[model samples]
Target: MNKKRLLAAAMSVLVAGSMLLAGCGQKDVKQAGSKPEGAAYKFRLAESNPAEHPVTLGDKKFAELVKERSNGRITIDVFSGAQLGEEKAVLEQVQLGAIEFTRVSASPLGEFNKQMSVFSLPYLFDSEEHMWKFLKGEMGEKMLNDLQPSRMKGLAYYTGGARSFYSVKPLTGIDSLKGLKIRVMQNKINMDMVAALGGSATPMPAGEIFSALQTGVIDGAENNYPTFVAQNHYQSAKHYILDAHQRIPEVLLISKVIWDKLSPEDQKLIKQAALDSVDYQRDIWAKTEKEAEAKVRDAGVTITEVKDLKPWQAAVKPVIDKYSADFKEALDGIDKARK
Candidate 1:
């Protein structure tokens, strides 16, 4: 072969090799960005309520938002009424990346992150406005960020409704609560608050509550009007006392593992959807409370709105002082929020 012809053949071979490598890189990129087949990204979202509850409404709305935003690239399977497990169990599943999402009351989260106890503090928030202000303010953002190290990402705060007292016997004043058995969330602050109010706190699961109330295992329980009515606790306990003591907020969370796997665009979509759903759920919650009150009233339950919370506040002040040391930052944040 001549020298010029040999050089031409070598150049042609190099060009062909370059084209093959470029083609492979393009194929890899396409594959990496492609959607999975058969199912969209399967996400298991669990909650601590039945499908008919407002919690389920929020879950369903979130799923619809994700599906719509992603054009059906993400599909969330919602397990309500503790089907996946209790709130604590589901939260652990989320931390381990075994579950994609969950809605939990901040009470149980206090065990994992003590800072969350701020939400458990009795009478910390003076009103619903104050509660929302603190939740959407800088303090709320800080509290939400506090979950990152625990491998959970907070999406939004849903209204759990104001905590109140209910009993088989009418509780007209703080004095009437003395020696009564009241079911509370398994949190130290809650136990202390019940004790301060002169009632014996019985920590139990929501699923076991109706049976407990029926069999006289517990004299009564405290929850929002909607919960008291929805759970049919009105049938077992005829008195609904509106103490409205602690306005505990329910937290919606996503697994950090799942969040990290998502594209930035997808993350933004999910976050926005969550925030929007909060507003929607809050509206539904208020209406639900009214309906619940009416329903229970019709069911022969006596509903009493406390004329003053000063006595109740005075009773639980010690609990605040005790838990305050561990939650100094949160207390400061709440104070700043008030200002």
Candidate 2:
């Protein structure tokens, strides 16, 4: 072969190889960006309700927002009514990267991060304004950041409403609660607070509350208005005392597994959507509480609005003191949050 002809053949071979490699690179990029055939990137979200609750509403809204913002690139499937199992089970699944998201009360989270006990403190938040300021401020960010180490990410806070007292008999004042068996969340602060308030605190799952109340296992239970009405505990415990004791906020959480898989742009979208949903849910919750209070009142349940929070606050002071010693740093943060 002539030398020029041989060089031309070699150049053609190199060009063909370069084109093949470029084609493969393009194919890989396409595969990475595009969804697989007949399959969506299903994000499994779980909550402990049947879609009517505020948390479920928030979950549904979050899914809708993600679908809209991602242009259908991401899809969230929510499992409500503990279908994905109890809150603790779901939380463990999230930690192991098996589940995508959940809305959990801070009580169970207290078992994981002791700092969460701060929220369980009775009378910690003075009012709705004080609660919002603390949660949307630096203190809230710090608390949210604290969850990262546990493989959980705090997205936003949902209003669980103010914890109050209800009884089979009328509870006119704090003294009326003396020696009564009051059902409380499975938390030390809650137990102690009820005890200090003159009720014998009984720790039980919320699901068992109605049965407990019905069977005289517990004479009363403390929770927000929505829970009291939704769970139908009002039938048994007709007297609703508006002690407004603890304004504990429910937390919306995402698994770090699903979070880390998100692109930075997608992360920003999800966070913003969650914040907006929080505000939306809070408004809905406030309205719901009003409706619930009115409905329960019409059902012949007496609603007593306690004026003297000082006695309630004074009673639970030892709870604060004990927690302060055990959780000094968190207490310090709460003190700063109040400012």
Q: What is the C-alpha RMSD of each candidate to the true structure, in Å?
A: 13.6, 13.7
Give lDDT: candidate 2, residue 169.
Answer: 77
* Candidate with maximal lDDT: 1
Look at candidate 1 and tell me the lDDT of residue 219. 93
Q: What lDDT, from 0 to 1, does candidate 1 have?
A: 0.81
For model 1, the stretches where C-alpha displacement exceeds 4 angstroms are 1-39
Model 1 root mean square deviation, Cα atoms: 13.6
Tens-digit lDDT track of model 2 for 88-196? 6677767756677888888878877778778898888888877887888777877877998888988888888888999997899999999999998888888888889
lDDT agreement with native, every candidate:
0.81, 0.79
* Pairs with backbone N, CA or C atoms under 3 Å apart (clashes), candidate 2: 49-81
Candidate 1 residue-wise lDDT, 100-192, digit = tens: 789999998887777887898888987898888889988797888789899999998998888889998887888889999989888888999
The parts of candidate 2 lying over 4 Å away from their true place are 1-40, 326-333, 336-339
